[model samples]
Target: MPVASPIPLAPVPPMIGGGEMGDLVRDTDWSSTALGDYSSWPASLRTALSLVLNTKGIAALYWGPQQWLLYNDAYGLALGDRHPAAFGRPMPEVLTDIAPVLSPQVAQVLATGDGFSIENLSMMMRRHGKEEETVWTYSFSPVQGESGGYEGVLLLASEMTQQVLADRKRDRAEHERAQALLRLSELNAGLEEEISRRTADRNRLWLLSADIMLRCTFDGVITAVNPAWTDLLGWQESELIGLSLFELIHPDDLAHTQQGASLSADGHAYARFDNRYRHKDGSYRWISWSTQPDEQQINAVGRDFTAERESASALAAAEEALRQSQKLEAIGQLTGGVAHDFNNLLTVIKSSTDLLKRPDLSSERRARYVSAIADTVERAAKVTSQLLAFARRQTLQPTVFAPAENLRALASMIKTLVGAEVELAMDIPEHSHFVIADPSQFDMAIVNMAVNARDAMVGQGRLIIRVGPARRGSEANEQPMMPGDQVVISMTDTGSGIAPLHLGKIFEPFFTTKGVGQGTGLGLSQVFGFAKQSGGEITVDSEVDQGTTFTLYLPQASEPREPRSVEAPHELVHGHGTGVLIVEDNPQVGAFAMHSLTDLGYRPVLAINGQEALAELARDASRFKVVFSDVVLPGMTGIELAHEIRRRYAGLPVVLTSGYSHVLAEKGTDGFELLHKPYSVEQLSRLLCGAMCTHFSRVT
Candidate 1:
């Protein structure tokens, strides 16, 4: 029990004091413990006991047997409103809901006089019209009597539910975060592989590109170069690094190259430019350049134009030569036509002169004049033959033979023409390469080239003839000479090369550099005509003071062909059975042909023109075995007359002659054969016999 403080009381009133005099006076003994049953006890003693109970939170409980109890405002709140009258009720009634909850606790406290404690005790209890679930720390203590036996149990508790729930929610969130992290790791790996693959592809593309690519800074320092750049320039990375780009330009083009670069750096690009670049071997190449520039860098691509430049230069030269060739062709045509007519006139004049030289005239003076006329006629004939050869109008007997051997055969003749000072060098291979062309024409072509080379060298330089195969194009087609073979006859000279101006016209007739009498200017023209007719091409390479190389591309022959050799027959026997019809516009020409046929023992009927020939053929088509007609007549053409003849007598052998061979050559035909104008008496007879014999054989 605890002691209490004493309070001093005032004196009571006389009327109230007398009535309660038997119990106590106003100032009774306050130290006494007993009241009610004994008058000697003080009233102060009762008040003292009440104060001690209230101060210690201890209340007196009235129960039939021992049970649990609690003290203090905190313990009352734990029981809630259900235990409102707790001081004198039974413990089970006071805490009806807590009876089960405190049964074990009460029993333990009763057995042990010492207090007991329970940690994390949980319970669901009703409070404030709802069930509250709570976890708490709790303690239960036993109240002891004087003998120390258990009297009741005291309860104390504390709630702790919020902290545990918070930790579990945090754990779930961390697990999800870990899963997302794993997914992100996989995605990163795939991205790495994709990036690596793209890098390799870009690198390969850069290396294979044909155009050189360079990445450089604005200051003109090259930072990188593609494989094409390194391969084309023939320089390694180390050798090119830190070298000024101007050093790559040729000495003559250095200023222009710098100007172009400067312009590009100033944000203005020169889209196209041409300059010379020095090769690694010190040789120069023409380069055409195009550039694309941006704020930070410039990209340039250059194409090698050396070949194209040379071709352009060659084409310009060829055009000039074409002009000269056209001029020469005009002259040759005029001279040839005049010479052909003059030869006919001379033939008649010379025949008359020969008749005048008969034995009847014995004067020396008259005989000398006749002999002089004959000499003049012979000279005139030689001149016409030369003109015909130069005009490329003469016929040729072509055969397959090696040009190298042919040139060797003419070595002595070429030496005589050039003079002893010039050294002749032959680079012709020993292996036989055959070409189909006239042997005489082939010889003449080589001799003419050698003569030109000799003249260009001033009779004191090396002249070389090289023969080999040259590809005509991408196809493996052989070079064609007179339309067949693939070999080139190259004539190179050590003398001064042809001038750029004259190189093209070098093949034109009468276009000469030689003094008046030194050359007829017909050599190269004849060579050109022979090559063109043989379906060959001639290309010339000449540099001032270096030398001239003339390459002749000819069709290669499959096998060696025997040289063309013909022996004239001794007898001039006429064809008596070969009946021929002559078609002509001019009476003189017609008479000449008729008489020539008559002398040759051929029965020939004459017609004035194609109309007359057609009329004659229509009258008696069976009488003519062959019809020899001139094409360009006064009325219809020779072809029309032949068609008319064929319509009447389809089996009749018709031979057509023309002055313009191009007209017939342009037409494709297997049955039609053509003979050009100015045929001799023998040609006419032979052709007639050949046509009649062929027709008879076919009929048989």
Candidate 2:
């Protein structure tokens, strides 16, 4: 209901009105209205009409119970198609569509005698030949009679439909612009991540290459130098770092190096740039360099191709002169440049294995990093195996399994890892559903996510892991997904949310918000990688100071995968007391191998090299059933030894071991059963027994 202010009635002065409605009011026959004939009208109604008729403001009056409509010319313009027809009719008759809407307001104004006003109130009225939505600002005031009581209501109104519609369109356009900016922001972040990855790869290449390499800022400050600096030039990395690169250059070749350095600083990089640097032993070494520069730093690889013969030196100098004169363009190729991704792969394997050798390193993390080392092999093969591994990231052996069950199994461990401070919650549905993914990787991803959430909450908050059906029609972050029944695994946290600026980069490799060395920034990246690789996607929703939710949408599998059957668990396979020849140069490793083999029911014979093993075999070839050898040996390499044994002993099995070697990178394991060094008794037994069992089966 609406209310209206009181309008004091004044004396009529026995006259008519003025303005456009003056002539109409003077000549109208008001007999049809409830006010009766025009001459019989009361002075109070006439005075109110006289004032309304002469007024400049838009006003209308509803007099008597029948509500006869009277308005000045200003109000008539807003009355669109019903202006003249609405002159004498009742207000309800004139606005047939909106009578219900206006009747209550009119009744309230007359009863309450209090003024009411509203802005942008919606109404549906007949306009443009159809019912159209409208917005209006109007005030209803109660009109008074000569007795000083309420009579009828006064109306003041303005239409705002056009302005409201225009503003809505503008707001929608702005929203679209914001979305576009977000996509652009994401693209820029992706480019930054690519550059960062390339930089890390270049750093690894420089550090591991069998050459002289240095990393420097654009301003000529050397930040890092390869270990070869000490081996080849008799200068420690600490002595050379923080010094200007130009300080060690040969005076004769300084001009040439400076020119190349200048070009690199300006982003023009080329291969085959040659120069000379003075060694700490007072001799000059001829070095060839290839450098690439980004905004922050320069990555340069240099090889010293010193000549032993005078004639060779002259020939090299002539070739270098000709090469420099002919080379004018930079090498724009990116694919052929990652020189030693293999070294990085080997580094990971060696580092993780070394950690595994420690008495206190936990088994879970050892398995995790070792698995990471295996994944690193794909990238290493890209350069050495002539296969594109970076082109096809992560190789997974996916099987259908229920995510809810896996989570439930791991809940106790997760709670322990997150500590007792944070509350853990699970919201899995009662019914069962399954998705296709790697089981080990699935376990690892969840642990990584739980640890990440724990860190985000600073070790105290609610962490929720939920599983349910994905909402198919809703598009998250405007990403398109495969059409299917998708299962979702959602991990939500009641911690500080990600900012808009950081949201676009949270999944990039090596991008982290944690302090240096605290995070690898690969947890969420692996989650995203696995989701996409398994034919699904991941989405994040966050708000500052509130919380975040990370959802993994995976295509639901129609049927559950059959579980693999294991014949024996925790069973040590034993040899049948046949002689096992162990070829190893390290005395400690040889003694350990002898003890382990004897413990496993094999009569072990120890040898220092391949020749000793061959001699042992020749003494009585029938006594030796298997030859175990390390890949790197004193006189003969293990790979060369394997070839020799294959030639001499056709039926003997050769098992080779190494941390990682150039031979393995180039030619691979070459059909021999190979094991990485520092293997556990379990892994060693598994390989040796499997090899022996295979040989026995083949012979029988």
Candidate 3:
């Protein structure tokens, strides 16, 4: 039996090569565990352990009734911080955090001898320092006993904590994004409602507006119109929609309307103009329009102002009527002044004539009476000349003369008129100022102003006369001057100023503040008329009890050529049988003219009219040395007759006489000698002699 000593089998080698974990399994004390000793373990349990240990993925075995833990190297790492201590522990103690979830699956596998798997099972465990959430997929399989009863549970596991956490984070992001999209959708809906409301409001305004609002194309074709268009223009919208806007415009307004339309078409932002539009009843109404260009069309608003225009025209007519009434009043005053002044002159003449009629009158006494009559006649002629000047009817012989020189020449006369009581001062520029006006009238105007100043001063104030060049229409002028270079003649007086009430009427005929008989009321009026006729203006500035200044603006003229030297006055020459033709329409004037020419030593012929005179001349053209004709004739005018004579008888000279001839005033004497009416015998003689001399020279 000693020979029968049992041969001991070599210690059983580890069934798996799991590296470090396999070595740990060999070193582990399974004796204290429910699985007991490894050498004495059942084949079923041993085989299960071996299979789990050799598994490449994470795997573990729970053998025996206690279901103690036995794991491979891969399964050990899934334990985190509890690795080595949980290697051989009972499953309930080793995975206490997931025991409740894993116990049921393990029991089911053991009882049925079946295998099962769980995907993404969640659990809480203290694998590290503290308890944390974890996810895993697991497989459970029953290990069969040797005798065919289930022994314990086998497990395959994979940790899914990272994949599960990432999926959960992605799901949270998707949910928040969906909420933001919903809020955006709600805001868009509210914005859409606001836009609809505004559109409705604009439509209401378009329908309810009272003004005539219209839309037209750039070419002026009406595309749309509001109700006001019908109310104002009496045209239906349908009827006007396709019509050209220009067609409804009055003919006289078409050009302006077209111009405005063109400006709009050229991209002008806004335009305003007034034009007339034809109404349905065939009358035109004035329409003031304001338009704005937009895109390819024009938007316009129109208002009717016809009633306002009619009111303005009525006001103008009323003003003209008032002016005419005032003119009639001025004429009445003028006639009254003329009658009074003429009666005084006539009384003097009548007395002088009656005295001369006394047969016992001595030579010296007769001469004195005659002188009185002559003086009265001279006064009457002066009155007539002033009236003519005030009426702007006198024929003016305009010459270009320097105003400064003329004023200097008249200083002595002005001094005499103003009296020694008043001081006279002059401010005249050395540079010459020339004007084309009647030299005598200019002098008379200055004298009249001086007299007015003297009267205003009551013979004891200073008078300052200033002469300077000025520009017409300059801002410095108180009254508008004629458009040209002008010479300003200002007379400023330190005297009692004119009252505001009488200032406006000072230039009216027969309008004056002077005492009756002290003035004819024609002085300032003559100045006014002369200044106007010569293309000038006069202005007055005054303050009550202070002073007054009268400024006369006369158009300046270019310097004139030196005048011909005048021959000294000589004895009147006689015509000496020179043939003179007298053309007069009035019989008495014709006879008087014939006698006067005969007395002047000229052979005279008389004709009642221009036609008769022409006929007489045609009969014997060379028989007349000169033709003298009245300006106003029954047939051909003096100007027309003279034109004919010049063409027919080139060598003949003509002399015209007129008191007031429109032809002479407008057209002037056409290179012919003009003799004023009511001429003295010496004047007639001198003029006729000159005409005859000119005729003789031409013939020779």
Candidate 4:
């Protein structure tokens, strides 16, 4: 074999002419790269590299298995910081930031021997000193070697960042302009539809409304009238049109109507008033007008409320009649109850008196009869007091006292009243709560409620009396209480609740569900009266078979002054021949008083009326030790007489007495000692002695 002459080495390919990238490629140590030296490079890679280098656009070749980078000056310039150092590096390493996006695309082109192209391909590149967002139109084309196998990938790119941004801006502006125009058109269409709808509605209202609609000039000349005017006033719209609106108004209403018109003329936005308008039959109909003022004109709607007014008047009359009927019925019930109760009391008294008159009666028997009479009289007095309380006409002595303290004091008494079978619990707050009210009446009310609760529970359930501070309207179910701080005393009982049908009438005097002798029914009534008279409200809530709660809200009072210690009861003391002036209108009562005073060892003088008493006093005022007068007199009232006596006789004690006097109840005792009627001999003696003692002390 001819010694194989050393085949001449293949000549090196000419260096690419890509300016800066070309110079870098020529100087690079390509043997160190996977693509090897350019002298051994495949024909296809050399051709691709030549095209990429000389191309004006951005282009690069990723050649061989390693996919080494060979980019043109334009592509190198686009590479920013990566530049010449990237010339001979592997494509994945050189384009590290975009490898994720570029690798798969390049692999696809190489494997399929296909070309891939995309527009606006976004890449984050470290261009300058920092990574920046750039967009480009780029493609990857496969390069084939001499053996017809895919060698690597060729990349061509054109930056689209500025172009794409500008196009998007212009498109956005056009879209916004289109949207604005569309909204404007919609607004115009909607406005037209709204105007048309409103106009149609106005026309329909004018035709169908029952109220008389009219337009008038500020000067009161009618410009237009709707058809309702014809139907309402029996005046045709044509007849009313162009006529002075004031002509149709009743003479009595003309002045106010003109004044209302002037308000509209003065540019008041709205005016509402009631006036009488003339009907076709010469009768006057009441019309309620609501007018709106427009430029130079007033549009008014007049509703004919004549029937409403007439109905209101008729209703009021009927209500008054009903009230009168109810009042009469209540009076009948009260009269019947009082008669029945008093008859029982009088029967005992009459029997006792008849027995005491017997000469053969034993001492003990005579004493028992007299005691029975006295006890019966006391019971009758209590009945009258309850009646007065229920009527809210009882005298009240209001003083500032701690309700909590009072409740605590009465807890034991309440327990006894509720009995051993019923559980009685008191929830009095630790802090003191003060209220201005009659303490005796308050205690009585509580006892009455306790008795009522015990009876409702059949003497065998729970009674909880809770006292706390409250604000008016703080509770949703409570009645409308006066707005202020309030002391709430609530009694809750687990008992058979009151019937709904009876709730409203429970406060009415003599109204009761209890059979004959079981209850007088004045207990709750008295409580109700006391609550109202004390400037407070009482509310009850109950459910059938469940329970009941009676809540009393009293106006809270400021902390009271330290209370003075109560004095012990005084023993019955004789008058010791002291002169007593007795003024009484009733003959029988006056005679009884004189006898009682004399029996108590007092010298007594009688005057039938206040003027007679004054005359007697003028005769010898110093003769009387103390003046005792009945409150209701023929000429001047007892309260008036008391004032006169005080004015005339300084430091002279005048004691006023009454069964029931509106003046005394309303104006109070007027700083004078008062004795309730139906007094016992002992009571009379004690009061007279106390009054005299007080006077003596003052005089001394």
Model number with the top TM-score = 4
Candidate with better lDDT, 2 vs 4 = 4
Query: Model 3 TM-score?
Result: 0.63
Would you list the C-alpha lDDT of every candidate in the order shown? 0.66, 0.76, 0.83, 0.84
Q: What's each prediction's clash count? A: 14, 3, 0, 0
Question: Model 2, residue 429: what's the lDDT?
Answer: 88
Q: Rank the candidates by lDDT, best first.
A: 4, 3, 2, 1
lDDT of 3 by residue, 228-294 (tens): 8788889998999989999998999999888888889987855567999999999999888788898
Worst 10 residues of 2 by lDDT: 1-10
Which is the leading candidate under lDDT?
Answer: 4
| True lDDT of residue 314, candidate 2 | 89
Clashing pairs in 4: none
Worst 10 residues of 3 by lDDT: 1-10
Off by over 4 Å in 3: 1-202, 216-221, 238-240, 243-284, 292-298, 347-370, 426-433, 468-484, 557-561, 566-573, 586-591, 607-612, 632-637, 694-700
Off by over 4 Å in 4: 1-210, 227-231, 234-244, 269-272, 403-416, 429-432, 471-482, 501-505, 543-547, 565-583, 598-626, 633-636, 644-650, 695-700
Ten contiguous residues minimizing lDDT sum, candidate 1: 16-25
Which residue pairs in candidate 2 collide? 4-114, 4-115, 5-115
Query: After aligning candidate 4 to the native by TM-score, how far in Å is the CA of 231 from where it should be?
Result: 4.2
